[model samples]
Structures are given as structure tokens and as C-alpha cells.
Target: MSAAIRNYALVTGAYWGFTLTDGALRMLVLLHFHALGYSAFEIALLFILYEVAGIVTNLVGGWLAQARGLRFTLFAGLALQIASLTALSLTNPDWLPALSVAYVMGLQAASGVAKDLTKMSSKSAIKVLVPANADGALFRWVALLTGSKNALKGVGFFMGGALLSWLGFSGALLAMAAGLALTLIAVAISLGSAMAGPAGGIKPKFRDVFSRDRKINVLSAARLFLFGSRDIWFVVGLPVFLASELGWSHIEVGSYMALWVIGYGFIQAIAPKMLRAKTREPDGRTAQIWIAVLIAVSAAIAAAITHDIAPELAVLGGLLVFGIVFAINSSLHSYLILAYAEGDKVAMNVGFYYMSNAIGRLTGTVLSGVAYLYGGLVGCLVTSIAFLTLAWVISAALPSRSGASTQS
Candidate 1:
């Protein structure tokens, strides 16, 4: 294999390991806390720090990765996760509610930092590894990486639930920590020193973390609403709905969610083929068209729920359709950010893009609880539609095929 391919493989492998643990951590915390009698809002609060930390981490991590090296950031991320996992294993059952919440939140913040640093490093490395002239290679590669990561994350969710049943919370966390520690050691030894080094030896300034390109800025704004649309329902609303209204068990809930995400990732991996992206690169117009369709789908789902027309079937079927389209949208966004970034500033631009992504998640997470509390699933779906519409409006500013180019 070529050196570029080798580095890409190493970076992707490391990211997979991290994503698995990250998914499991989320499941473990949500389920464990819920079982301990925490309210839905309180459970949501547990993750607030995680999303908030991502905002700062992405902005700062972009600069750090550019100055230090992708390898440095990647290693730091893994180390921090390991530390967070170990700390979490020390949680005492006898602690006060406030104390426990504070402890877990602090640890989650560290994991958030770890997640974004590793993500920014791995994604930016692709810009360096893939040749600029390779037709459609960037899209395919990014989709594959993103898709596989999500698939593995879904598996991790299942694993988290199973481990909780078998080993309880502390044991499950310790096991993940041990596994990740081994993965970290392997990555440190295997990856080359220059895997994600600074481009052209130029020292990137902190201000460069924000993008100046109009396309990137518009796309980033669209991305913010696009993701918020998904999480507004996906995060708190859907899961709580499943448990409370549908009477689904924890295993059942986890399994269904895992299946959805796995299928979503599969679609993402094959999006290039499905969308015929090879013939012509997807652009702003492509995003707008897909999102418009998504808005219709979201509206239909919401309407079905409101009218009580086979609500269960509407939700399950609608989400399947939603996942497919959303996967394509996400894959396109991933490709576009990399496409728009200058080679010398790939890390910084990616970081900025993901900062917007984190903000979207934060917004949706907060609203998920509030919306659900007020109007249940119908409320959540309405909120999702609103966000999708905003995303569609923002996407109108994106350059069409004539102006956009995927070639970096």
C-alpha cells in the first residue's frame, strides 16, 4: 500500500477505537443514571457539559493540532479518554446526588475534549493523505470513515447495555478503559511521526481557526441547523418516548437505536454510489434539494403523529427515511468542508466546522427535553421540522455546481 493509504488506515483505525468507547460511555451513563431514578431533564444535563466542551475543544484543538501535529492531538485525546474512564470507575454509590452529578459532568467534559481533538486530527489527516487530483476519492474516503465510525458506535451502544447487564457500571467502564489503553499503545507505536504534521511548516494563528471563505461559512451555518434538526428528537425525546410511551425495555431500546444507526452508517458508506456522486460532485444545490425532501418527510411524520394515524408505524418508517436522507446530507457536508479547506489550514477549518456542529447538538439537546415535556413526540417532530426548514433556508446561500468545486 502507498504511504498515504497506510497513514489513513492508521488514523481511521484509531478513530474507530475511540468512537466505540465514546458510544459505550454515552449509553452506560444514560442507562445507569436513569435506572438510579434521575429525571429525563437531569439525564439530559449529564451530557450538557459534553456538548459544551466540544465547542471550546474544536476551536482550540484546531489551533493545537496545526501547531503541534495531528499525532499529538490524537494521542492526547486517547489519553484523556483513558483518564476519564478511569475516573468514572471510581464513582461511589453513596455520594450525594449533587456531588455525583458534578463528578460525572467534569469527567464527561474531559471526554468531550478528547472526542473533538481526535476527530479533528483524523479528519484533517485525510486532506493531507488523499491526492488532490483523485476524482471523487475525497468524498468516498470521508464517507467510509464517517460511516464506519458510526456503525462501530452503534455496536458500542449495544455492548454498553450488555456489559451493564453482566458487569454493572464500574466493571463495564474499567473494561472499556483497559481496552482503550491497549488501543492507544498500539496507535502510538504504529503511526508515523509525520502522519499529520504542519503543512509547509507554517505556524497557524489562533484566529485562523475560524473560516473566512463564504461557502464554508454558509455551509457551516447550514450544518448547524441540519444536525440540530436530527438531535432535537434523537437525543432525549425519542429514547424517552420509547421507554415511557412504547413500553420498550432498555435492551429493546438500545437494540433498535443501534440498528438505526448501523443502517444509517451503511447508507452513508454507500452514499456516493447511491447518489451517483462519482458522475458529478455534490454541491450546495444537492444539499438544498435533499434537505427540502427531508423537511417534507419530517412534516409528514409530524402530521401522522398528530392525527393519530398509525403513530408507531409512522415514527419507525419515517425515521428510516429520515436516516437515509440525513446520512447523505451529513456525508455531503463532510466532503464539502474538506473540499473548501485550503491544504495548509485543513485542521483549523475542520475544527471550526465541527464547532458549529457541536453548537447544533447543544441546541437540540436542550430543546429535546423542553419540547418533549410540552408536546411529547409530536412536539419534538415539530421542532425538528422547524430546524430543517431553517437549514434549508441557510443552504440557499450555498454556491451551486457552477461555482463550487470538490477538488481540493
Candidate 2:
């Protein structure tokens, strides 16, 4: 019933809507284009801009959020998504291949901007809305929001596939656009004007968008590798391995992936409880411990694949363990970014942190293809172990809970 809680709810709700559509759009584009006879690499090119655009969007979006408040950026993101969806719906089936690819990529770039802008806005809003005196509340809130968002995204993937089957591409896009428009209107009316300004009334300089805090910088570096570790195998290698080596059907592979994501989200939601977060706040030490565990798990999985020791069982069981540990690591990192952030500059700090995250994804995605082609799943797992080791080493520099304030 409190104003802060209400705003948090509003922001989370809007983000949920946006994430659902974002996931759906990705599936729609991939499946639709593949069905239209586009080569796999060409289809992948359509998403390259989406990832590339995120790097810039997070950097600039932070500054924009600081200047105009989280509300502005949130609205801008939703609006841009609506426009992007509508534009995609307008694509001409008869257009030349080059023209079509360029057009879709451009629209996907717009969607990327939309995704990051809304993400930064929603996440930054949490620091503003949560009372500073509430012990351990930040971690729980961040976990819930992030976990639920991922779960919904998995659902959206299914929804996208179903919609394409029922209504085709254009109809599905238009429907999603209309649904998002309504959510946008509802959010605009419910979230009050007080949410429309930067925290602490500070007029943040554009250059302030880059983080200066040593802890933040260290954490950012760790985050880059942490995500890269996941994507290196998760993106391409694992799926291909299941399909080709295990001889699984496409539906079976898709189902397993969707379930994995949903399960991972579930683990994330419960991470705070699993880690006894309420007993104490997490810090760099916490991240270091988790990353160390992840490194061991990654190495074990790679070894199993190399030795051909129950490879299927090893992959299935190892991945489950990896997912749980990684979720906790991810949840802790999310909280730390917000916890370490200066109140007035939370938007910019979150933006800068996520920029590193985007870069990690880009790196991992490209490496996933190359590694899988040359080294297969074992190679990808080896790369993941390397990335995790780097992340663990970098996390060693992070300040402890007692030292958190010194950096800020």
C-alpha cells in the first residue's frame, strides 16, 4: 500500500510486459525467417545489430534516465518497441533479400535500444523506490524482479511460436504491439509524477554515465566474464550437441532449453533464501565463492565430455548444478550493483554495469559459434571454465561487505 511499494510494482509490471514481448519478438523473427528459407547465418545477422545496439543504448540510456528520470526512459523504451513491432509488420514480402535483411536488422536494432532502455529504467527505479533503511530488502526485490522476468520470457517464447502458428507473422506482431500499447497507457496513468525525476535531484553530467568506483569497475569486469562463460556454451554448443550427438528432435531440444531457462529463473527467485541472504548482505567475497564453485563445475563437465564418461548424464546433471550456482551468482551480482551504486547516480551506474554485460554476451555469442565449430561442446566448456576463472580472479579485488562504503 505504500507509495514506494506501489511504484515498484508498477515498474516491475511494465518491465514484465516488455520482456514478454521482447522474447516473443526474438522467436518470431528467428522462426519466421527460417521458414522463409533464410540461411542460418543470415538469420543470425538479423540479431547481431540487436546485441550491438544494446551496448550503446545502456550507456546513453543511463545518462538519459539521469537527466529526465526513469519514467521517461521507461516510456521511451515501450514506445520504441511498439514502433519497431509495427515497422516489422510493414515489411514487404516481395522485397529484395538485401533490402529485407537490412530492414529487419534496423528494426531489430530499434528493439534492442528499447529493451535496454526499459531494463535500465526499471532496474534503476528499484534503488530509488526501496527505502535505504530496509535491511536485505534490495537483494530480495532484485531477485524477484529478475527471476520473474526470465520466467515470463520463456513463456513468451512459447507464446510467440503459438501465435505464429495461429495468426502468422504480421498478425502476431500487430497483436503484441496493441497489447503493449495498452500496458504502456496503464503504466503511464498509474505511476505518479513523483517518479519522473532523478534521485537526489542531482543534475548528472553525461560523462558521469561511466562508473568511477573501483568496486563497480571490478564487479563489471567480473560480470563480463561471468555472462560470457554462460553464453559460450549455452548459446550454440549445448543445443547442437543435443541435436547431433544425442540425436534429439528439434522439439525436444527446444523444450529442454525452455525448461532450463524457466528452471534457472526459479532458482534465481529462491537464491536469496538459498543463500540465507537475510542473515547478512552479500559482497565481493560472496561472488568470489560462487564463481569458484562455478569454475569447478565447468571444469568437471568439460572433463566428463572429454573422457566420454556418461556424457549424456554428465551434461544433464552438470548443467543443472551449473544453472543453480550461476543463478545465485547472477542474483548476487544484481544486488551488488544496486547496493554499490550511489543513490543519486543509480541509473548511470546500472547502465554502465549492464554495458559490460552486453559486451560479454556479444563476446560469448561470437565465440560460441567459433568454439563449437572447432572444439565442439568440450571446447565450449573449456572456454567457459577459462571465463569463470577470470571472473573469480577479478572478484578477488572486490571489497567485502565491511568495505563497501569505502568505495562509494
Candidate 3:
């Protein structure tokens, strides 16, 4: 195959594999912890550990990608991922629960490193493959791949759930480890034949690492608010509304998540056309503004659906609407990054995007937990409205689409 095709295929395949491993681990471990009698707070804490790992490695990965070149970073990330998974698979009986969480944390950190590195590297490679003015096209391609990654992750979750039911946690973990090993092999082969940069000899100072690219920093700020509201909608708010108020089973809820993911992927599959059309329009900023609004409206609808309407139908309906908003948000994020970020700092931009999201989730989850305790579903609705309004205001501070100023 041609060079461009080879690089895209390799990178896409590698992402698919990594996402599958991540999905399996997340689904299996949550159930395992629940079965081991961990409380909701403990479960959240474990996930928090994983997020912490991601936050640290995300920055490191960005710096490494900038200095070490794409191939080296990618290889190192894959190796670390494999080692972490193997260690998780081999944890002793006494360390079952404790080691399990630790193992997952390592995996998440390694995966974060790999993902951020690969993305930055791929962006560089893709830029060379496509013409300079075709950034819009590049955005569509990357968005489609991202949507595919989510779809594969959902499938992995579904499969993992089924496997966990049959093989138990240890069995599922072992199987996941084996799969991850194979994926690492695939990435290695792709790297061998792919056109990649020599590790840049640039040794960045601490100051440079900490310095925020003005454009990415602003985009990260918008993303933070967006995700903060999303956490309320997803983790605390959605689960409570579905289970306690609507009377859905956990399995049913899981199914709905998978369905939401499928719908998310479907919309993303067509995101290229959407991006193309929006690129031509004058209301890019207006459409971007509506993202937070739609999310807020969806939250309101969820509250309404649970109050007087059919609970189950309301959730399904809310999910469908949320899916559309999510797609738009995802595309807008990529567009903003490509439009404004410097070419060399894609990893930093992506890392900050996720780091902002992590902070948003941490804050939102805490507040939503409080809401769950004090006001039940209504509290969640209130929190959604409040935070989403703030998000709207924050988005207005973002640089408008007139190709205007991109302040940090």
C-alpha cells in the first residue's frame, strides 16, 4: 500500500486495539470491585487513581513526543502498557483487590502515554500526507477514527461484560492481557514500515513544558466546562435517574450505555459531512455555543422525563439527544485544536484537553454526589442547569470563529 494508507491503517489499528483493552479492563474491574464489596466512594476513588495517572503521564507523553519523536514514544507506550497488563494478570491472591486497582492505574497511565504520543505523531505524519489547506479534511478523518475508537471500545465492553459473567474477573483479565500483547505486536510492525521522524534532539526545559500554548490553553478551558457538565449528566445524574427513579436494571443500564456509544459512533461516522458543511457557514460560533445549551436542555429533559413522564422512555430519549450533542462537541474540539494549535504541540494540546476534562469530571462528580445525597434527581437537574450556564458563559470567552484572537 501507499505510505499514507499504511500510516493511517497502522495508527488506526493500534488505537482500536488499545481502546479495546481499556474498555475490557474498565468494565471487568468495576464489576469485580462491586462484587468484592467496595462502596461507591471507593469505586470512584479507584477511577480517580487511574485519572491521576493519566494526568501525569499525559504531560510526560507530550514532552516525550516533542523530544523523542513519534516512533520511540509509541514503542515505549506500547511496552509499558503490555508490562502493566501482564503484572495485573499475575497479581497474587492476597493482593487481589489492591493490586487490581494498582494494575489498572498503571495500564491507564501507560495507555495515556501511548495515546497522546501516537496522536501527536500521527498528526505530523498526516499533515505530510495531505495538502496544507486540507486541515478540514484531516479533521474529518481524525474525528471519524476517534468515533471508531469509541465504537470498538463499546463492543469490547459488551464482550467483556459477557466474558466476566462467564469467566470471572481473573479469566477476563488474562484474556485481555493476551489481546493487548497481540496489539503491541501489530503496532511494532506498523512502526517498522511507517514513515516517522527521528527523535528530535530538542531537550525542553521545565519552563517550556509548563508553558501553555495560548490557543490550546483556551480550548482546554472550554473543554473543561463542557466535560464538567457531562460528568453530571453521565456518572452521577444518568445512573441515579435510570436506576432509582426509572427502575432499570444495572444490565439494562449497561445496554443503554452501549447503545449510546453505538449512536455516538454512527453520528461521528457522518461527522466529516457535518464538519464540511459547518466550515462553510458563518454561524460556526453560534453552533458551538449551542453545544452547551443542548446539553443543558438534555439535562432539563431528563429531569422532566423522570418527574411526570415515563422514566425509562425519558432516559432513552435523553440519551438519543445527548448523543447528537456529544458528536458536535467532539468535532468542535478537534476543529478548534487544528485551527489554532501549533503543529509541533498536538500532544500538549490533546493532553491539556483531557487534563481539563479530568478536572471537570472530578469537580462535577463531587458536586453531583452531593446532589444525589441532598436533592436526589432534582439536585442533579439543578447542578446541570447551574454548571451548564457557567459553561455557556465560559464558551463566550473563547475566541470566535472569525479567525479572531486566540488568547491563552
Which candidate comes out best when scored by lDDT?
Answer: 2
Give the better candidate number (2 or 3) by lDDT: 2
Best of the two (1, 2) by TM-score = 2
- 1-408 per-residue lDDT for model 1 (tens digits): 887788789889989999999999999999999889888667767888999999999999988888888888989999999999999999887888889999999999999999999899889888888866677888899999999988899999988888989999999999999999998898788775755467778898888888898888998899999999999999888988889888899778878999999999988889999888778888889999999989999999989988889888998899999999999999989988988887778888899999999999999988988999999988998999899999999999887862324344
- Estimate candidate 2's RMSD in Å: 1.5
Tens-digit lDDT string for candidate 3 (1-408):
866667777777776777777777778767777877867776666666555555555566656666665666666665666665666656444666666566666555655555545555554444334345442556566666768877887887887788789877777777777777787787777567453453234555534555366546766776676767766757777787778877889988888887778678767667767656436522237445667656566665756665767656666776687778777776666555554555555445554566676677777777777887887766676676676666666666565653511221
Give the clashing residue pairs of candidate 3, or none: none
Give the per-residue lDDT digits (tens) of candidate 2, residues 6-83: 989999999999998998999899889988899988999999999999899999999999988899999999999999
Candidate 1, which segments miss by more than 4 Å at Cα? Answer: 402-407
The models' CA-based lDDT, in order, is 0.88, 0.91, 0.64
For model 3, the stretches where C-alpha displacement exceeds 4 angstroms are 92-130, 193-201, 211-213, 278-287, 302-307, 402-408
Sorted on lDDT, highest at the top, how do the candidates line up? 2, 1, 3
**Which ranking of candidates, highest TM-score first?**
2, 1, 3
lDDT of 2: 0.91
